[model samples]
Each structure stands twice: as C-alpha cells, then as structure tokens.
Target: MTKPIQGFSKLTKEEKIDWIVSNYTHDAESAKIILKRYWNDDEALQNLHDEFIENTITNYYLPLGIAPNFLINGKLYAIPMAIEESSVVAAAGKAAKFWLDRGGFKTTILGTEKIGQVHFMFSGDADKLKSFINSVETKLRSEASDITKNMEKRGGGISKIELRDKTADLDNYYQLHCTFETLDAMGANFINSCLERFAKTFKQEALHFSEFDETEKNIEIVMSILSNYVPNCLVRAEVSCPIDELADNDTDANEFAKKMIQAIEIAKAEPHRAVTHNKGIMNGIDAVILATGNDFRAVEAGAHAYAAKDGKYTSLTDASIENGIFKFWIEIPLAVGTVGGLTSLHPLVKLALEILQKPSAQELMQIVAVAGLAQNFAAVRSLVTTGIQEGHMKMHLLNILNQLGANETEKATLTEHFKKNSATHSAVVEAFENLRKGI
Candidate 1:
C-alpha cells in the first residue's frame, strides 16, 4: 500500500510526478515519459493550463471537430464540438445538412430565470417570521447592491425574493427562495454572492426584530447556494418538412416519419429506453457545451431533472406527422454562459465561441438545444431505417484499426474491404492478418 504524503500540493510539478510514479506505477520511467509527452511545448501555455486546477498534471486533450451547415433561425453556423466519441460530430453534420434545405432548425427562448436559496432554521411564530421577512426584503436587496450593480447595468439583476415556510417538510426549516436574470453569464458566483449577502442581512435583521424571541432571533442559517436545476431557463428547437422530403434512398417518406414518431413514443413510455434515448440527445448537447467551455455536468443535471419533472423519466424530444408534414422538436433546460469561466481563458474555447459568431446567452441556449435535437434526429433516423450500428460501427472502424496497430497500407485496404462488408472486430482482425500475409 502507498502511504499518503504531506504537502503533496506544495511540491514542484516534476517532484509531484516523480513521487506519484515512484509509489503507484509499476513502470516509473514509462509513466513519467507518458505524462511529460502531453505537456505543451510552449512553456507559457503549459503554465496557463497548470493554473486551471489544483495538483495539476499534464493536460488531457479531446478532438475539436466542426459540424458545419447548422441553419438555426435562418442563420448559418458551423458548430464546433469537442468530444471523444467517434460518430457524434459526423451524425450532427449529417442532420444539419438534411435540414439545411428544409428550413433548418427554428429555436425559441422560453425563459431565462435562474434560482438560488438561503436555507435556514427558525423555531418561532410563522406569522412573525413572515412579517420579519417582509420587513427586511428591501434591506436584503440593498445590502447586496454592490454585487448586483454590474449585472443590473446589463439589464439583469435580482428579479424576486420570497420567504417560504417549510416546517411541514422539516422541523422549523425555511428558505428565502430567490430568482435572478443573469443575462449572458451563467451567474453561479453572482447568485451565490447575493445569497450569502441575503443570509447575512436576514440573520442580522432577525436579531433586532421586536416581535422575535430568543430562539427566532438566533436563526441558524444552513447554507446559501445556487441550484443547478434551472427549470425556468429553457429553449426549444424544432425541424419540419413535408413528409415526401423525409424519404431517403433506403427509407420511405411516410413510413419513416411514422416510425420516427413511434420511436419517440416508445421512449416517452419506457424509462429503460428513455435513459439511452436521452443519452443520445446529450451526446450532441454535451459535445457543444464542452467545446464552448460551458458546464456540461450542470446542464446534464438540469436536463435530466426536467425530463422527470412530470413525475416520470421520459424522452426530451417529441415527433409527429400531421396533415402530410413531418415535425420533430425538443424543449430542454440549458443554463450556459458565453462571457465567463473557460470561455475567456481557454484558447480553444475562445475559438469555439468565435466559430459560433459570439452568440448571446439566450442565443447559445437555442443553439445548444438544436444540437441536441439534431443529434437525436440523426440517431432515430438510423434506428428506424438502416439500424444505428451500420453508421456507428463504420465510423468506429478507424478506432478498431488503430487499436490493432494496422499499418497504413493494411488500414486503407481494410477500410475499403469493410465498406463492401461488415466491420466486425473478428472480421477486421482476420482481414487485417490476411492482408499482412499478402493473401
């Protein structure tokens, strides 16, 4: 067993790597070589990466690919995606091209409200607590004015704050539920700062309230934090065309539309299926989110929660064919920002935003939603027609070839061979060996 070391974080980068490999790795030299291999050649750039987090190691890289031909709201965009998955970018591109001539994706911003709370415990008269809150509401806003001034100047600030009595759920538990308009920023820090200020002001005011007794005056503030679940921050994206335009070389127009609707219905009905179904949608959303330096984890949490908002887990998308028109759409909660966090620091993130044409937060929400919808559309079209594995495994062929250590000639030959046959692992291995043997 490896022993824990003190002041490990205080060690120099080289010393930290030396210690880690000496204790934990079987081949210390190989481990050290691999770690340093990923370091940025530019010393200043490597230093910038090291400062992004604590106990820094060599940077991890993901391929940044472009999925062009996204026509959202009558504007063309070549979306950038950073993901490790093989077929995601290709699928998104294919979806975009399919809709490019069909009026493309249309998006709407339904709302942009975010939430935070100051949870506290109060064991006093409920009416008195309400009166105390009502009295100090203005004080709470005024105290946090310094923090909200810049946001207010940008047409976004504290929207509303309300006191809620939750004694029925937990003993003497209460909350100062607050909502905000953060505009182009995700505003986690802003919301949290405002919440802490509110908690401090509320606690101070409680001590001076004439009607409050000792227990009520000593209100124990549990925590002040922003919620990742922003159900009100929502956008909707949809694509539609005449049923005849939905046809392809292999799939009938009317049958394809009906099958697409049926697949969505199945996902809406079954949790097991819905999980995978929504995961396909996230494949696109998360790719763009990561590329653009947004919080994919936060977006993922809020999106799944919204899917289950109606008491059950279901599909995030819907489809229908009515009066000869095929339509599909997705309305999802995505709280993303364009001006903060990695958007300003990471070089690739800056490039990604520039590729997106420097969209505002609401516009970014719409684009993200459309990415998800387009991805799902591509996946479902495959599932109902040629089957998903056909395209997915075809894209995955390169991975398999690389893993098998195929030479350039062998890889090229096998790739062409698989185009005329199946790219199964065993089949590729056999073909690769035979090719190497000149058979």
Candidate 2:
C-alpha cells in the first residue's frame, strides 16, 4: 500500500514529479517524459505558467480555434474558441456563415448587476433585525469605500443592500443580500472584498446598537462570499430572417421552422432534453469564456441557475415564427470579464481578446451570447434534419483514426472515405484493417 508523504508541496518541481511517478506510475521514466514533454520551450513562459497555481505541474494544452464570420451588432468577429471537443468550432463556423447575410446576430444587455451575501444566525426578533439592518446599510457601504473606490471612479460599485429574513426555512437564519455594478470586470474579487468588509462592519456595529438586546447584539456571521447566480447580469442574442429565407437545398423553410420550434418547446418542457440542449449552448459559451480568460465555471453556474429560475430547468433558447419571419434567440446570465484574471497574463488569452478587438465587459457578454445562440442553431438544425451523429461522427472520425494508430496517409484516405459514409467506431476499425491489408 502507498503511504502519504509530508511536505510534498515543499519539493522542487522535479522532485515532485519524481515522487508522484515513482509512487504511482507503473513506468516512472515514461511518465516523467510525458509530463516534461508539455513544458514550454521558453523558460520565462514556463515559469509564468508554474506560478499560476500551487504544486506546479506541466501545462495541459487545448486547441485554440477560430469560428469566423460572427456578425454581432453590425460588427464582424472571428470568435476564438479553446476546446478539445470535435465539431464544436466547425458547427459554430457553419452557423455563423449561414447567418452572415441574414442580419447576423443582434444582442442587448438587459442588466449587469452582480450579487453577494452575508449569511448569519440571528436569534433576535425579526422586526428589530430589519430596522437595525436598514439603519446600518450606509455604514456597511462606507466601510467598504477603500475596496470600492477604484470601481466607483469607473461608474460602478455597490448598488444596494437588503435584509432578508429566513427564520422559517432554518431557525434564526437570515441574509444580508447585497448587489453591485462592476463595470468592465468580472468583479468576483471586488465583490468578495466588499462582502467580507461588510460582514466585519455589520458584526462590529451590531454589538453597540441601542435597539438590540444581548441576544440580538451577538449576530453570528456564517460566511461572506460572492454568488454565482447573477440573474440580473443578463444578455440577449437573437437572429431573425424572413421565413422563406431559412430554406436550404435539403429542407423546406416552413417545415424547418416548425421543427425547430417544436424541438425548443420539447426542451423547454423536459429537463432531460433541456440539460443536453443547454450543454450545447455552453459548448460555445465556455469555449469563448475560456479563450478570453474569464471564469467559465461561474458563468456556467449562473446560466444553469437562471434556466431553472422559474422553478423548472428549461432551455436557454427560444424560437418562433411571427409575421413571416423566423426568430431564434437566447437570454442568458453571463458574468464575464475582458480585463482581469488570465486576460492579461496568459499569452493565448491575450491573443484571443485582441482578436476580439478588446471589447468591454458588456461587449464580451454580447459576443459570448451570440456564440451560444449560433452554436444552438447549428446543433438543433442538425438534430431536426440530418441528425446530430452524422456531423458529430464525421468530426469524431480523426480522433478514432488517431486512436487506431493510423498514419497521416491512412488518415487522409479514411477521412475521404468517411465523408461519403458513416464513421462509426466498428466500421472505421473494419475499414482500417482492410486498408492495412490492401483490401
């Protein structure tokens, strides 16, 4: 049995790798080679990556691809996507090209308010607690002035604070729900700093409040943190064109519109379908979020929470036919930043944002929303007509070929063959064997 080692993090990078591989890997030398293979050639760049997180390890890489011809708000953008999944970038490009002449995508920023909260246990009377919070709101804001100063100069800071009583749910449970406007940034660290300060000030002041009894004065703060459920930080992206314009060589426009609407409706009503449907939307959103060096996990959390905001998980997108026009749109809460975190640090992230023209936070939000909508359009379009596997499997063919040990020449030939045939795993294996045997 393997035993845990002490001070593992204190070891040098090489020592750490040696310990890990010697203890766990069957072939330690091969494992060491694999780990070291991904390190950057530039020493400075490799050092920068090593400092990104604790217990440094070799960098893991993903393909950074561009989905071109995304026209949003009268401007054309070639969205950079960092993802390993096959067909994602291609599908996005296909959707963008399809909508290029049809008034591409239009987006609107509905709101940009973010949330933070201080959870506490109050054994005092509810009415008194409410009055105390109301009177102490200004003090809470003032105490965080240092943290919010720079943000305020940029026209964003604390928006509001509210006292929420939840004694019924859990005994003596309550929350100091706060809101903020963080312009041009994701605002997680900012919001969290403000919240921690608020928690400190609120607790310190409670001990001296004249209206509070001994029990009320001892307000116990549970935690102070930013919430990843910014329903108010929302953006909408939509595409609309004449119904007949949606027609392609293989599908009728009216029938296509009907089927698309039906597919969306089914997703809206069924959680199973909605989960997969929303995943496709995130496939686009996450790729852009990752490329731009924002927090995709937080954006994902906020989006999924918003989808189930009405008490049922449903589709993040909707479609309809009105006035002889087919419209498809998505309204999602995306809290992303173009100026912080990895945005300025990572080389690829910098390139990705530059490719996007250094958009503001709101502009980034719109672009991400458009990417998601376009991706959904492509996925649903495939689902309702040619079926998803046809395109998905074709894109997945090369992955299978690589796994089956096919060389470049065989890959090229097999790729051509699969273009005219289904690329199922078993079928590819049979064909690969035949190709090697000169069949």
Predicted model with the maximum lDDT:
2
Please give, for residues 1-439, the per-residue lDDT of candidate 1 as tens digits.
8888999999999999999999999999999999999999999989989998999878898999999999999999999999999899999999999999999999999999999999999888999989998899999999999999999999999999998889999999999999999999999999999999999999899899999988779999999999999999999999999999987787789889889999999999999999999999999999999999999999999999999999999999999888889989999999999998988999999999999999999999999999999999999999999889888888999899999898898778888888988777788888888887889
* Candidate 2 Cα outliers beyond 4 Å, as residue runs: none
Error of 1 at 198 (Å): 0.7
TM-score of candidate 1 on Cα atoms, chains taken together = 0.98
Model 2 over residues 1-439: C-alpha lDDT tens digits?
Answer: 8898999999999999999999999999999999999999999999999999999879999999999999999999999999999999999999999999998999999999999999999988888998898889999988899999999999999999999888889999999999999998899999999999999999999999999999789999999999999999999999999999998888999999999999999999999999999999999999999999999999898999999999999999999899999999999998988877888899999999899999999999999999999999999999999999999999999999999999999999999999999888899999999999999
> What TM-score does structure 2 among the candidates reach?
0.99
Model 2 worst lDDT window (10 residues): 335-344
lDDT of 1 at 9: 93
The positional error of residue 204 in candidate 1, measured at the CA in angstroms, is 0.9
Q: Which pairs clash inside model 2?
A: none
Clashing pairs for model 1 are none
Alpha carbon lDDT of each predicted model: 0.94, 0.95
